[model samples]
Target chain A: MLFDVQGTATDFFTTVTSDAVRIDLGRNPGLNWDDFVNRWRVAYFAAVAATPTPAGTWTSVHSIYRRTLDALLDEAGVEYPDTDREELTLAWQRLIPWPDTVQGLRRLGVRYTLATLSNADVSAVVNLSKRGGLQWDAIFTAEMVGAFKPDPATYSTAARYLGLPHSEIMMVASHKYDIRAAAALGFQTAFVARPLEFGPAAEADTEYDDAFDLNASDFLDLADQLDA
Target chain B: MLFDVQGTATDFFTTVTSDAVRIDLGRNPGLNWDDFVNRWRVAYFAAVAATPTPAGTWTSVHSIYRRTLDALLDEAGVEYPDTDREELTLAWQRLIPWPDTVQGLRRLGVRYTLATLSNADVSAVVNLSKRGGLQWDAIFTAEMVGAFKPDPATYSTAARYLGLPHSEIMMVASHKYDIRAAAALGFQTAFVARPLEFGPAAEADTEYDDAFDLNASDFLDLADQLDA
Candidate 1:
């Protein structure tokens, strides 16, 4: 099972928001940290989507996130210092896993191999998984493949390295676009809903979609559905 | 900490020999499984040593091992069936971990980020590590980098993906050549002597060389030496 890590397993909003608030505690107070984090997420999505796919021209997700953070801060007319900006950007490397994330992975891991196929840089995935106590049998990241998810090269390269046909590999993700891309490449798809992914106030698409091969409320439900 | 997984962490000798014995129990009974495994290891070393390092021309260790297995079996005049030959070759994917491998890694992991930097194919390393219950924060395999160990690309590429300065990353291995290659690239070196890596009768080097940054008898001793 290949996991889409950012929002599906780890709660990036909480981590980025918490770090923003902590960094801006006395220096840059009254800024809506939550909104800032949400925008940061959206900006990150836009940055990756806009990135070109050819191998040598690829920029790492870490560089893109840092650049996005700087642009947003500059646009908001905030004077968050360089160190704090870096720390906040690095917050992506320590995102906390959801309550059921670890247990559910442990359950599913018994019957299947688990790995990350994320747009995040290799270091970010490694550090985040280490910090979150997320045990994966292997890890595949955009840094190694030189392309972000939704780019066919990302999934195709990982499939090559895994030495497994696309049919045997299931893409388990919370986002429809991610699973859809994997499904396009003949990969089995499992959609796990993270209703509060964007935040408590934001409405995330939580309804089960029959387009995916399987759908579940969360990882635990996914494990149960797969009988793992 | 970057580990050389095959002999340093996992007992490839015992695993391969046991599989060979089981596969050749009724037929080819007189063949010395111990000698066969040692010769296989030697041949694997020679095969990887001969491989060129340019990216696209590189071959996976899995292919090398499988080819080497076929050659050795054919030379021995043993009529090992294709299925048994394939199964025996797959034994490399299920190598058993050394006694202190798991416990020592667990201890060292608290203070350091542990990862595998192996000559093995990604799938083989992943499968063996999973079966052995050996936990690593990240995995860096030769197959991903398009070169085997002792080639500068292998070490440099892994260090790049790790996002760490070569000075800060320590390469830990049982073989001096492996650590020496890492040391040449400015990585700190740790030598863990595996006395039985070849087999009980073999004169495996268990000597401590001051040339390495540190040397220990086993993973536990290495952990203790590093105060992990």
Candidate 2:
């Protein structure tokens, strides 16, 4: 079993609200929640898209997040806050799980060796698992492979850690990109729809148009599909 | 939540019966179950006591088990056989939880973050957790630290990985040595007594006189003490 973090198990907006208030009041005098959310979105996607080049050049997710956030601040006619990037990163740690996440994961834990194969670091995943009351057999991270999702090596390494072949393991997520990556590598894929992942009235194009092995509307639905 | 692997979870002697028969058939050409049990007792303790020192450079639990079996053969005046160690180890994988273990662990899991900090490798522990229907928040192993139990680093690292301070985490084990070590490192200790860990008639020392934070007759007793 697998899980996603932000926008899946956790509410990205709630986490940003508290973090924005904390950061804005402390060092940044006029930063607003909307500005923080937009900057965070830019940072999040930039991190997902950056990659290493063939010339041995490396572009880290953290670096991408930092650069993208800086550019967003500039575009918004605002100066980049003098807050520590590490402190900003720690905001991700305080994310609240979705309403169904805890109970759904508890149910799944009864049958499968549930794990999180997300882009989150091992430490972040461990912290989230503890706070969310999620029991995971193993916590695999992009940090372990030094690469992000859509990389076969990450999925293969996760399977190796689970002591199972790719065919025996399943990757469960709300993101088609992640599920598609695992599917191409021979893993069973399950999708959980997150209609409000980007917030109300935001068009997410929440459809698994790509060929995925299984799709569900929520974690409970995923559990039903797997158990059935 | 912790578990005692031997009689508390699985019948150790019964599981290894085929392995014992194969060894006897290849070596002495004829040996009884009594002889096999005797040899196994020596091998098991010897395996436990033969931890590597700095200069000695201890081996992994897998390698130690292999060497211990070899020594057992030599002591029993038998020859080494080509019996499958992996298959024999898989018998360990199929361990049955004591009638109380499942209920006890389920109760404990409701309150605390349950995990297995075992001498068993990650794969072995994961398999046992699956087979026993155990839902652990994390499954840690000596393999993570490349060191066995009684090492402070192992307990400390396990606690650290849980994102908890040593005092917040607890070490639960049947072995006094494991609890003592963990207690010295500031982790709360709970000892679950297993008088027949060695054998029923074996006259092994059963009293846990160490200063463990809590000592109980069984996992259920432990659950009671922990207010689970």
Candidate 3:
């Protein structure tokens, strides 16, 4: 099984926002970090969207976050210390796991080979998995594949390395677009819903679709459905 | 830390030899299967040695083993069944780990990130690690790097993916050639002494080389020296 790490397994939103609030809130009480973090996530999404898959130079997701954060801070006129900026960028490497992430992974790991197929840089994925106490059969990243997720090359590259056909492998993610891309390439898709991925105020798409091979509310539910 | 999985952490010679004896001894009581397995290992080394590190079409270690086995059986006029040959080839993927492997990995894991840097296919490494109940922070293989061990590209590619400099990484291996290549690239080298690597009848090198950063009798010794 290939897992999408960002929103599916780890709570990057809460982790990054908490780090931001802890580091900067005392100095700027009026600054709404929730909105700032939302903007940061949106900027990251845009940066990745603009970058093409392979055939040219590849920009790492780490660089994109660092670069975009600088641009965002400049626009907001927030003259943060250079150290703080670096620390916040490093925060992406140690995102907190969702409540059921560890337990579910432990359960599913017994019957299935679990691996990370993330758009994050290989280092970031390794650090995140290690920090979260997650044991993966192997760690794969866009950096290794030379393309981010949603690219056919990314999914195909993972399948090739695994010595498994796309039809036999399952792609698990909380995002519909990721599963949709995998499905297009003949991979079995499991859509795991993370209701607070974008925070409590935002409405997440927790809908079940027959189009996907499996649908569940969280990773534990995913494990139960898979009978792992 | 990067590790050579075959002889350093696992006893491939014993595992393969035992599997061969179990499957073929009854059929051919006159066959010296131990010598045959040794010859098989030597052929594997020669095959990888002939292949270029990069710029050529890369062949996986698994493919090399399978091909060489067929050639060996043909040369020996063994007339082995195709199914038996396939099963023998699969033996390399589930080699038994050294007695100190899993426990030492568990201990060192608390203080450092542990990963495999072996000349095995990604799937083989994954299967071996999972089956052995060995938890690595990451599983890296020659297939992922496009080169076998002793090639500078193999070590450098791992460093590139890890976002770590060569000086900070330690290459642990029973084979001198592997650690030598890693050391040439500025990586710290740890020579692990596996006295019975070739079997009880063979004299294996268990020497202490000052050229390497450290030398240990086993994984547990290495862990203790590293204070992990």
Candidate 4:
């Protein structure tokens, strides 16, 4: 089974926001950290949307994160040193897993080969997996494929590396778009619901969808339902 | 650290020979199994040497094993069924690991990311790793890179995936040719001595080369010296 790490396995939103709170450089307690974090994520989404064509030169997720962070900090009037920005951006690599993530993955790993097929850069994913104590049979990334998720080449590249047909490999992610794209390409799809991926106050779309091969509330639920 | 899996981590010679012994369809006891195994290894080497250009059509190691087995059996005047040939060819994916491999890799993993940079097919390496209890942060192989080891692209592809410079990532292998090739490309080289890689009766090379960045008797010794 191949997993998408950012939201499905680990809570990047909480982790990055907490780091912003801890390293409050120019922020007053009156400042709404949640709103600021939400804006930062919005900017990230916009940046990804504006990414160059897959055939263009490679731009790492680390570089995108750094650029997005600089733009967000400037807009928030939060002055920060260059070194602080680098550390804060790197928080993505050290995000903590959800309560059920590790155990669920361990159980599933006993029955199936577990791997990470993430948009995160390969080095970042490697660090994240090691930090989160996740054991993957293999780790694949957009950097290796030279294209981000939802790109046909990205899914096809992973299928090629795993030496499996698209029909045989399962793509598990919290995002519907990711699952939809994989499904269109004949890959098996599992939709994992991470209700608070944006934040605690945000209303997440956690409803089950019939289009997905499997809809799960979390990793544990998914593993149990799969009889792993 | 990137590792060479076939000989450095697992004893493929013993594994394949034992599999042959178990499925003795047309074997004569007087026929030396060690000699037959060495011939198989030589055929594998020739097959790799004769591999088509990286950009050519994909050729899996498993397919190469079956082809070579057919030729070897024919030469030895041994008749085997197609089913038996397929089963024996898959023994490459179920090789046993060296005694110190697992522990040494575990210790080193605490400090540095561990990955495989093998000539084997990616799926085969993944299966071998899972079966042998080898814990790797990432799995890379010739199939992923579209070229075998000693190919400049193979080493460069691994460095690209790791998002590290050639100098920062170390290439650990038992084969001198692999080390020399990687060293020329500026990768840190570690020569791990596996005395019985060919077989118990074969005089395998285990010399410590001063040219290499580090040379040790085994994975554990290499780990100890690296202070990982």
Candidate 5:
């Protein structure tokens, strides 16, 4: 099973917003960190989708995070030192896994080879995996594929490296677009709902749909459904 | 640390020779399974070195292993069914780790990120890691790099994906050639002696030399030397 690391395995919404709240505690008591974090994520997704592919040249997720953070901070009228800005940008690297994530992954790993095919940079994913105590068999990323999620090259690159037919490799993600892209390329899709992925104010769409091969409430539920 | 999986971590010689002995038990009592396994290793090395890279097409180590096994069986006058040949070639996928491999990796993983930079295919390394109870942070291979060990592209691809300067990522291997190649590309080199890498009948070159930055008897010793 190939996992999408950002929200499905690790709880990025809580981690990032918590970091933002902690960093901006005294300076901006009125700031809604949850909204700020969600907006930042929307910017990230847009930036990655719009990032240009110039053949040999590469743009790292670290740089993208930095760019998005600078723009977001300016738009929000927030002031922070360069070091704090760098730390805030690096919050993605220190994301914490959900309560059921580690045990569920361990159980699933026993019966299946579990890996990450994340949109994050390889280094970011590596650091996140280590910080979250994730035991991934392999880490594949947009940095390796030279493209972001939803790109045909991304899924194909992962499938090629896995040496498995697209039909045999299952894509598990909290995001519908990621799974849809994988499904279009012949991969099995599992929609794992992270209802608080946009924080408490926003509820993610968790209703079961015919589009995905499986719908799971969480990692543990996914493991149970897969009989792992 | 980047590890060479086939020998430094796993006891492939013992695993392959035992499989050969079990499979060819009644077929040839005079056959030296140990020697046969050693020769097979040599053939594998040669084939990987000689595999062609024609632009975008890939040559997986699994295919290389199959090719080498067929040639070796023909040369050794050992006739086996195609299914048996396939099983024997896949012995590489189920190699057992050395006694200290798991414990030492756990110790090292506490301090430094540990990954594989092997010549094996990604899926093969994933299976071998799972079978041998190895907990690697990431798996990088020749198949991912589109070339074999000792090739500049192989080492560079790993360093690039790791988002680390070659000097920051230590390359650990039992073979001097593997370490030397990595060292030439500025990767820190650790020579871990696997005295039985070539089987008990053949003595491996275990002498510590100035060429490598660190030399240890085993993974545990390496962990101690690194203060992990």
Candidate 6:
């Protein structure tokens, strides 16, 4: 549930397959990974930025991410292909859990409830849990709430579902923006540092402040910090 | 925080302490543990039975239990010393984990999300998790939804908050009624056969059929099933 893109799971960008995707772009002379990434990023932001606020409240991360993905495909002039959006979405379901994730979560499991409050769909999370060998009493996602993280409702709803007070539940994430919103709502927060989340340190913003209740280098360190 | 009332935790039942006020129930000229427990049981059920339902919904365990206690005191012509209620409540908060609960959860934690969706309040669940040394990704209770088990809302709310579909979430319980309701709402269901949940050989009417996806004799067995 507390996952980052790229480096957290498989080193996709460095993998032969991902490198091939990049190579294909490079060979197109007019297109490159950087340009393609930039274009997708722009479309992602534009789509999220354009979403109408509901009853004066901001749009949720769930909505933003979903719309962002839609916009990126549209702007790229690419169709979803035979896999369709649902199967493509299932990619998240089969993502490899980080090498340390299973053991770390196992250790933490000795002392706390471990769940992923991700942007993935419920079925995706279920399949991911099954495939990754990650067990959770619950797997929460933005899709369930029809909104995304950084939204108070998402965190609050999670706590409410767990039958816990906001203060009693802790939101552990690799993103500051996610933790900041959780903290504002009175939930305890833990930061799991995923330095190469976006690719490499040079391309990633790996710096974070000591604003969380606890910060760790990885899931194992997090387990140590929680005394699991 | 899977726990048994009599054997697991030291703090659950009311202890006969000199500091605690005693209601001399004329029926049991002498205060015995059995007598006290019988009276408490009656108070507990009566309280639950008296609660006013919402529309078609039933009264929650908390409301029923608290009210029942209050009414029992009134019927016995006894006034509980202020300390008595606090001590009794504290006892509830102090339930000990079953011996297998901690280790079993740790094992299951390696493969699944483990949580307590109980009738206990959030505080009680949190405290139990801490006292019993059990780690749950989330702890759910009726207080979160303002409704008790067997109500569709409780399960639905839990699924929504965890960002999971009802089907992806599984409910593990000793009570058949709870499992039935959860299954009815599309949650994967498992029943832990607490044959002695009520007392020695006093079966709890735990009949298993197609409703449950898995049924096991204990937490360890549940772990094995899920792991397999």
Preferred candidate (DockQ higher): 1 or 3 = 3
Model 2 C-alpha lDDT per residue in residues A1-228, reported as the tens digit of each score: 767676778877767666766655655556566546755775777557655533223344445556666666576566534565456556666667888888788788777777787776555676667776766767666655556777787888677656688898888888788888888888988888888776664556468654778777778887777673
Listed per candidate, the RMSD to the true structure in angstroms reads 1.4, 6.1, 1.3, 2.0, 1.6, 7.0
Displacement of residue A207 (Cα, Å) in model 6 is 3.2
Candidate 5 chain A, run of 10 with poorest lDDT: A53-62
Distance from true position, residue A138, model 6, in Å?
A: 6.6
Report the C-alpha lDDT of model 6 over A86-162, residue by residue, as the tens digit.
34333434556667778987788667765667654454565556666775545566554456666677787677555
Q: What is the lDDT of residue B68 in candidate 5?
A: 85
- Answer with 3 or 5, whichever has the higher lDDT: 3
Cα distance off (Å), candidate 1, residue A49: 1.7
In candidate 4, stretches whose alpha carbon ends up further than 4 angstroms from where it belongs are A26-31, A53-56, B26-31
Worst 10 residues of 6 chain A by lDDT: A8-17
State the displacement of the C-alpha of residue A47, model 5, in Å, after optimal TM-score superposition.
1.1
- What local lDDT score does residue B55 receive in model 6, on the 0 to 100 scale? 42
Candidate 5: segments with Cα more than 4 A from true spot? none
| DockQ of candidate 5 compared with the true complex | 0.80
Q: Which stretches of candidate 1 lie over 4 Å from their true place?
A: none
Count of clashes, each model: 0, 0, 0, 0, 0, 25
Evaluation by TM-score, superior candidate among 1 and 5 = 1
Better of 4 and 5 by lDDT: 5
lDDT of 2 by residue, B73-171 (tens): 566665544565445445545555555777888888778877777776566667766776766666676655556677777787677555578888778
Clashing pairs in 3: none
- Using all chains and alpha carbons, the TM-scores for the candidates as numbered come to 0.97, 0.72, 0.98, 0.94, 0.96, 0.62
Q: Report the C-alpha lDDT of model 5 over A110-222, residue by residue, as the tens digit.
A: 99889999988888889988888899999998877777888899898888877789999999998999999999999999999888888778878777788899999998999
Poorly placed runs, candidate 3 (over 4 Å): A53-56, B53-56
What is the fnat of model 4 with respect to the true interface contacts? 0.78
Tens-digit per-residue lDDT, B119-165, candidate 3: 98888988998999888999888887677778798899899888899
Docking class of 2: acceptable
User: Which structure is stronger by DockQ: 3 or 6?
Assistant: 3
- By lDDT, rank the candidates, best first: 3, 1, 5, 4, 2, 6
